[model samples]
Target chain A: MRFDLIDHAMAVTGAIIRVLVYSILTLPAILVVMSSFTNGETMSFPPTGFSLRWYRAAFENDLFMTALWTSTYLAVLVAIIALAIGFSAAFAINRFSFRGKAFLQGLAFSPLIVPAVVLGIGLLQLFAWLDLTQTIYPLLLGHLVLAIPYVVRTILASLTLHDQQLEQAAMNLRATPLRVIRRITLPLILPGLLSAAIFAFVTSFGNVTVSAFLTYGGRVTLPVQIFAYLDTSSDPLVAAVSSLMIVVTMVVILAIERLIGTERLA
Target chain B: MLAPMIILLTGFLVVPVLGLLRSSFLSGNHLLEGSGFSLEQYFHFFSDSYYTSVLVETFFDGLVVSLICVVIGFPTGYSLARLPPLARRWRMIIVIMPLTLSLVVVVFGWLIILGRNGLLNSLFVSLGIFASPKILLFSRPAVLIVLVQQFLPFMILSVMSVVTQIDPVLEQAAANLRANRFATFRKVIIPLAVPGILVGFNLVFVLSVSAFITPRLIGGSRVAMLGSLIYERIMAELNWPSGAAMAFVLFVSGLGFTAALNALAASRFIVRGRRHAL
Candidate 1:
């Protein structure tokens, strides 16, 4: 009887701890979402009289709109480029065993270990030395480096679980290698590819560290713009912009969840 | 097939880093100055008391935050592993939701919560814990709090992955052998969980040490970390060589620390035929 009672107490303690930790994890995003709806000019908690004025303000601000446009197109280009490289690389790494394969794999994943700030500064120097700092190429290239690892990781997971027998069966039917890949392998890994694209998109879109170094003239990414704005001012427009980002992130996350299931993602 | 990735990585990632490394030895403000190589930048870093203290504090902060993540993450992970599949799936989404959001947005949330007359202060004051709202932002503790929040998901996921693989049958066998719950946990579960804990520790340490946004915003100008310091030197001061030296130092220390932990973990645990745990 005493043992059962102790077990019950322990279970309760564990449950409480889990709840607390989850709350702490979600609290920040929740607060940002809540305050973004404020009617007042300044941001305040227990927000005063809910309104969408700040969202309007965020949209009306040309600087933020330009940043949003820049971030969108930049992220799209990064996703497409990263997918091309990541898909080919993941396919090769997954299918073949050759000399220097391990070295190649490590090199591909190496960016994850390197600090983003280090990457930013190094790229900044490289671009400046090459006289390419004035163009948008630096941001694209920098974000591609940041996004490729994620794309490769997601696609590799999918490829590992893929059935090679299907590809072999298709090839045995006299299909060419390209046809077999297009008809069998590509179709099979479509979900993984979608998830990988989302990963690349989110990574490039949300990046600030590397983009901070690479943003030239007025072509800043949305997150970097927000960072700069926050450094100078405190207002509800920042909250509105942050909430929109959170919404976009949540939508992408949900889309990924729908495609691959959150279990594989987590 | 692998040509494009290799070429891109070598050109953009590898070459740029090498360029930065080469410039670190040069004595010039601008990167293209072609000045003669010297050890002046590294010497300046070591000779300066401020830079040295910042380096020490960065490592110290990383250790403290990683330790806290392990302490808090272990229990949560254990519970998560024991959860039913349906419950676990929904909860996993919640766990990863914050991770999907931009770090800047997350920091903004913290800014509101920890700001003067913000959620924390207002709540505390309403409860008479203090006569007035205390200044909570732009401090070391605030930086630590945000860092832990930012990186805790990685720790939880790492621990959960390992804990989920530990069979429940072992625990049942221990109980059948007359072991108590705590004894079963200590002897069976903890030994199996060490690899996961080490991985989580290494990850959190590396990430927190390299973190820039949280320390910059929450800690503000009051706190100086290696990430912010490197940014200041390179971006604000235009001291590319000095910044490159600091970046190299940060990279080498992170690599060395991770390698040391892996070696220690491998020698102590994996060599005893538990290699599969990692």
Candidate 2:
């Protein structure tokens, strides 16, 4: 009886600790959302009153608007390009048996292991050396490097979950190789491809460390703009902008949950 | 099919990193002006006390943050694994939502929470925990807190992945063999969870060690870390050689730590496999 009582007490303690830790993990986003509606000119906790003036301000600020557009455009391009390359690479890795297969796989996933700061500085120097610092190519290439790893990892997981027998069966049924891929393989991995695109988009959009180094000619991504803004000033506009991003990210996450299920995501 | 990816990686990643390495060995501040290969920048890094301390502090910060993540993440992961599938799915979303948000947004949230007259200060003052609002922002502790928040998800996910794979039958078997809850946890659970814990440790360590924005914003000029230092040198000071050297150091240490952990994990799995065979 005493042992059962002790076990019950321990379990309760563990549950309480879990709740506290999880709360801490989610506290920042909750606070940012709460403060975004502040009526005051400056950001504060338990914001003086509820209003959406900052959101209006964030939208009206031309610098911020341009950054928002830039970020979205860049992220879209990165997602499409990363998906095309990642899908092909993942397919080849999953379906082929060839020499240096392990090396190719490792090289594809290598960016994840390299610190973003290192990659950022390295690319900054590389572009300077190539005299390509004046264009948008540096930012695009840098983000692509960061986004590819996640895309490959996601598509690889998706590819591994389903077997190749279906592709083989299509081939056996007198289907052309391209036809088999178009009819069988593409449809089977549609969810994975979608998930991979989402991953690439989010990775590119949320990037700051790499973007900070690569932003040039007065064109900055939204996150880097926000970072630079915070360095100079503190205002509720940032809170509003951050809250907007939180909503967009929540939508993306919900989409992933719907597509692949969050369990697989974990 | 793989040609495009291989070409992209070789052109961008490999060539750039090689350029970085080459620049680190260049003698002068300017990359092009340096005539011959030299170790001047590395010598400067090691010979200078200030720079050496920053390296030490960076590693110290990584170790502390990694340890805290393990301490907190293991329990959370265990609980997450124990939850019902439906409940677990919702909780997992909440856990992962912050990771999807930009690091800047997350750090901004911390700035508000830890700022003077911020939520934490206001709450503490109202409860008489402190007589007045305290300066919580722009401090080392604040940076550490935010870094942990930023990277904790990685640790939790890693641990949860492994703990979910542990067979419940073994735990039940331990219980049926007269093992107490503590005994089962200490014997079966800890032993099985070690690999996950190690992987999480390496991840959090590498991440927090190289973290830039969080430390730059929260710690400000008061707390200097290698990541921020690299930024200042490369961007603010235009000292590319010195910056590249520090970046290379960060890269090598991260790779070395990961390799050591991989070796350890491989050996552990081998022992576990042998035991299973027996």
Best by DockQ: 2
Single out the weakest 10-residue window by summed lDDT for candidate 2 chain B. Answer: B269-278
Flag regions of model 1 displaced more than 4 Å: A1-13, B28-31, B271-278
Give model 2's docking category.
medium
> Which digits, one per residue and each the tens of the lDDT, describe model 1 over residues B58-146?
99999999999987888898888888988887788788887778889999999899998589998989999979989999999999989
Name model 2 segments beyond 4 Å from true: A1-9, B261-278
lDDT of 1 by residue, A121-193 (tens): 8888888878888888889888888887888988999999989999989888999999998999999999999
Model 2 error, position B202 (Å): 1.2
Cα RMSD for candidates in order: 2.2, 2.0
What lDDT tens digits, residue by residue, belong to model 2 across residues B1-278? 99989988988899999989989998878655565799999999999999989988998899889888988888888888878998888789988887888999999999988988689998999999999999898888888989988998888988998999999998888788877787777778877888888878888898898998999999999999899999988889988889999999888977787788778877986587568537
lDDT of 1 at B154: 84
lDDT of 1 at A170: 88
lDDT of 2: 0.88
